[model samples]
Target: MSRAQPPIAVLVALSAVGPLALNMFVPSMPGLAATFAADYGTVQLTLSLYLIGLAVSQLAYGPLSDRFGRRPLMLAGIGLFLVGTLIALLAQSIGMLIVGRLVQAIGGCAGLVLSRAAVRDLFDRERSASVIATITMVMVVAPMVAPLIGGYLDQWFGWRANFWLVGAFAVVVLGFAVPLLHETNHYRQPLPGLSGMIGSYAILLRSPVYRAHIALIGFASGAFFAFLGAAPFVVIDLMGHPPSDYGRWFALGAAGYMAGNFASSRLAVRVGLCRLIQAGMGFMAAGAALMLTLALAGQMTLLALFGPMAMIAIGNGLVLPSGNAGALSVDRRRAGAASGLSGFMQMGLGAGISTLAGHLVVDSALPLAAIMAVSVAISLLAFHALRRANRQARELAARTRPALPKAA
Candidate 1:
C-alpha cells in the first residue's frame, strides 16, 4: 500500500462512484420522460437497464480483476464509465440515454466489486468490516445530496445538464484514481486459461461460509433495493408529494443508514461481526414487520412508512459491511473472485427484488411493504444459517484438537 493512497481512500473513491451513478439523475426522470416524449415506464427503463447492466457485468469484472490486477481493471472500468457519461450527456433520444446508462453501469460495476476486493486485500475479517463501515458512512452522502442537486439542476437548466454534471464528476474521479489507486492484489497470480479460472471459482463456491455470507448480504440489500425501487411510486405518486421532496425523505433515511455504518465501524471489533450481523437482521425483521402491520391495517401514513423504512435502512447499513467482509474473508488469495461473486449475488438479488417490487406497484402500500418484509425474512434465515455453520466449525475444530493433550 502506498502511503499517499491508503486502502480506505481507495474504497471511498470507488464507492462514491456508485451513488453518483444511481442517484445523481434520479430527480430528472420526469423531465427525461417529457424531453423524450416517452411514458414514465419507458423513461424508468433507464434505471432498470442500468441495474441489469451492473448485475450482469459483475460476473465478468470479478474474473477479469482476479486475472489481471485490481488497479488496471478499475482504471479501465472508470474510463468506460467516463465515456458512458459523455454519451448520455450528448444523447438526443430516449434510446440513446438508455444505452448510455447500460454502458455506465458496466463500468460502474468495477468500482462496486473491486473496492470490496481491495478491502479484503488489505485487512482481515474484523478490520475489513470496520473499513467497509467507515467507507459506507462517507459513501451514503452521495444519495443524500445527489438527488437534491439533480433536482435543482433540472429545475434551473435541463435534464441533459444532469448527465453533463455526472460526466464532469467522472472526469475528476478518473484524474484522482489514475495516480491515487494502487494495485492491492499482491497474492493474485494470473491464471493460465479459462479452465483454471472456472476451477478457481468452483473451489470458492464450495465454501459453506462464503455462500452463507453472500446470501446474508444479498437479502439484506434486497430490502433497501425494494425501498429504492418503490419509494418514488409510494411517496411522490400515491402520497402526492412533489418529486423534489424525495431528497429530504431520502436524506433522512440515509442519515440513519450513515449512523448505523458509523456505529458498526466502532463496534464490530468488540461485539464481533457475526453478532452484529445477527442483531442487525433482527432489527430489520422487526422494522419490516412493523411496516407490514401498518400497511395491512389501512393506517399507513407516509411517516409510518418512512419511519420503519429508515430503521430497515439502518439495519442494512450494519449488516451489509459485515456480511461482505465475512464473505471476502473466507479466501484472501481469491479476494477478487470472492468480492466479485459476493457483489454478483447481492446486486443480482437486489435487482430481482427491485424489479419485482416495481411491477407490483399499486395504489396501496401493501405490495411495497410485503416485498420489504419478505426480503428481511430471507436475510434473517441467512443469518441463522451462518450462526449454525460457525458453531459447527468451532465444534469440529475442538474435536480435532487431540483431546487437549490430557494435561488437565
Candidate 2:
C-alpha cells in the first residue's frame, strides 16, 4: 500500500541485493589486484573475509529481529552496507578494501535472512514457499548478469566504479523500501536471557524434523554446488571444450534452474510441499544417476556433464524454496533464528561440497560424478526420513485423542 513499492517487488529487490553484492565485483578482482599491486592470495581475502562476515552477521540478525522488529533492524543493516560501500569506493589500499568488503558482507546478509523471515511472517508455509521460489528465480538473474556488468564497468571505469554502483543501489533500494516494509513480527517474544535463548536453539536442534529438513536442503543443493565446482574442469580439461563454451553451457544449466523455479511457483500451491519435494528429488536422483552412468561407462562427454546437471539444478531450485519455508514454519516465533541457522547450514555445507568436488576431480570426471550422485542420494534419504517422522507424529496424535464425545 505504500507509494514506494508493493510487498512482493520489495522482497524480490531485497533478495536480489545479496547476490548482487556477493558476485557483482568478481569480474573486477584482477583489476583490483593490479590497482593495489597485491597478489591473488591477498586479494582473495576480499571474498573469503566477506563470506565469514556474511555467515556471522546472518546469525546475529535472526535473534535480533526476534527482539526488535524486521523494519528497523533491516534499515540499520542497509545503513551499514552503504557505509561500507562508501568506504570501499574511497579505499586507497588493499587492507582498506578488504575491511570494506567485510563490513559490506555484515550488512548485506540482512536482506537474505530477513527477507526469508518476512516471507514466513506474511504467508502460510506452502504459499511462502511459492513466493520465495519466485523471489529466488528473480534473484538468480542478478548473479548471471553481475559478472557481465562488472566486466563492462571495469573496462569503462575501473574497479572503484563497481563499489560506487553498489552504493548507489543501496541508496535507491533503501529509499524505495522504507515506506513499504511493515513490521511483520506480530508476536514479540520477550528478550531472552542467555539460558532461554540457548534453550530455544536446543529445542530446534533436537527436532528430528528440523534436522532432517536442514540436511535435505544441505545435500540437495550440495549436489548442485558440486557440479558447479567440477564443471569448468570437466568442460575444459576432460571434455576438451573452450571456456566460452562452458559459459554457454553454464547458461543452459542456469536455465534449468529457472525452469524448476517456474514449476515450483506454479505447482507448490496445488500439489503441496511433500509431493513437490518428492518430484524434485526424483529429478535430482535421475540426473545424478545419469552422470555416474556416463562416467562409469567411459563416455565422459560434455553432454554427460551439463545435460544431467541442468536437471539437478532444476531439482535444487524446487527443493531449496520449499525446504526453507517448511523449516521456518516449524518454529514460528523463531523464524528469524530458524532462517538464519538453516541458511548457515546450507552455505557451510555448500562450501564444503564445492571444495571436496574440486579435490575429487584430480583424476577424472568420474569422481565429480560420483560425489554429486552420492550427495543427492543422501538428501533423498533425509527427506524420506523426515516424511516418515511426520507420519508417525500425526498417528501418535490421533491415537492420543480423548473419547469425551461418547460421554457427551
Residue 116 in model 1: lDDT: 77
lDDT of 1 by residue, 29-140 (tens): 7556668899777877777778778877887777777778788888888888888888888888999989998899998889878887877777788998998899888888
Pairs with steric clashes in candidate 1? none
lDDT score, candidate 2, position 90 = 87
- lDDT (C-alpha) at residue 183 in model 2: 76
**Superposition TM-score, candidate 1 onto the true structure:** 0.93
**Top candidate when judged by TM-score against the true structure:** 1
Regions of model 2 farther than 4 Å from truth: 1-6, 25-49, 86-98, 151-162, 227-249, 292-305, 358-368
How many steric clashes between backbone atoms does each model show?
Answer: 0, 0
Error of 1 at 326 (Å): 0.4
Top lDDT: which candidate number? Answer: 1
Cα lDDT, model 1, residue 5 = 37
CA lDDT of every candidate: 0.80, 0.78
Error of 2 at 232 (Å): 5.8
